[model samples]
Structures are given as structure tokens and as C-alpha cells.
Target: MDLPEIQSIDDLALLVEKLKLGLVSAATSDEYEFSDEEYKRIRKILLSNPMFTELIPSYLKLCRNLSGVWQYIKHEFSTYAERRGFHY
Candidate 1:
């Protein structure tokens, strides 16, 4: 299948959803938990993506080096100035 072009932030949001990472949420009260293996997978997948540098460079760097939980991603993505989730 052909992939859609990443021409806008909305496209990125759509792509992220399909990755199954979901929108991040802050751990202000409750934190989501993940297995050690899953955590490693997240880190590995994130660290390898260079496109993040073009979107939110600092935030992407933090996600690559410092993030540990799903909530952190949600919180970080919250900075995106558009409505999230699959729109179609």
C-alpha cells in the first residue's frame, strides 16, 4: 500500500495513531505502566526516527533521550497546535 505524505502536522498526528502509541497524557495523578521490553521498544523506535527533529526538535530530543512512559509522549504531543486523532 502507498503511504500518505507527511505534509502537515495533522498527517503526523494520523501516523502516530496508527503506530498504536496513542495520544500522550500527563501523569499528574495516575501513571500508565508498561513492561520493560515494551519500554525498550519505545525508546528504540523513537530514537531512530529523524523526522521528529523537523517537528518539535527539543521535545523530540527529550523524547528520544529522557522519556520513559506513554504519558510523557501524550504530554509532549499536546504542544502540537492542532486537533489530534484520526480525522477521516
Candidate 2:
């Protein structure tokens, strides 16, 4: 599928939705999370693809490494939930 140009937040959100579905489909197909080899291949693809560069800036991008980003996402969602009066 052709990726849409990410010129704004709405475009970016669409890209995110697409990515979410793709990842979910891949995980279901594999019956598990990505293996090391699969992860390496994915990394190679992202690194080589020019399309990803537009969505992420050089300084703010975290896809090169994702553990920190995962943690950050968790924290961000936790903060958001707190603001909305949601709790554990």
C-alpha cells in the first residue's frame, strides 16, 4: 500500500493506525512477538526506507531503539489516564 504523506497530525494518525494493524496482523501470523532475526530484518527495512524518515525527525526519532520509547509510551498513557481520573 502506498503510504500517505505525513504533513500534519491527522496524516500521522492515519499512518499510526496502519502501522498498528500491520503489527497486529504480523504478530497473529507468527503466533508470537518478533524473533531476534525478524527484528533485525525489520530494523534493516526501517533504516533503509526513506518513507520512515519523514514521520520521524533525526533528533526526536526512537525507532532505532524502542525499549525507551515503549517505556515513554507507558508513562505518557499513565499520565493521560491520571488526568482523566482513571486509576489502577
**Residues 2-88, candidate 2, lDDT per residue (tens digit)?**
333447767656645444443333323324354434433444444455777675434225534334334444564544434233211
lDDT of each: 0.41, 0.43
Clashing pairs in 1: 24-74
* Alpha carbon deviation, residue 64, candidate 2 (Å): 3.3
Cα TM-score of candidate 2: 0.36
Best TM-score goes to which candidate?
Answer: 2
Worst ten in a row by lDDT for model 1 = 21-30
lDDT of 1: 0.41
Q: Give model 1's TM-score versus the native structure.
A: 0.30
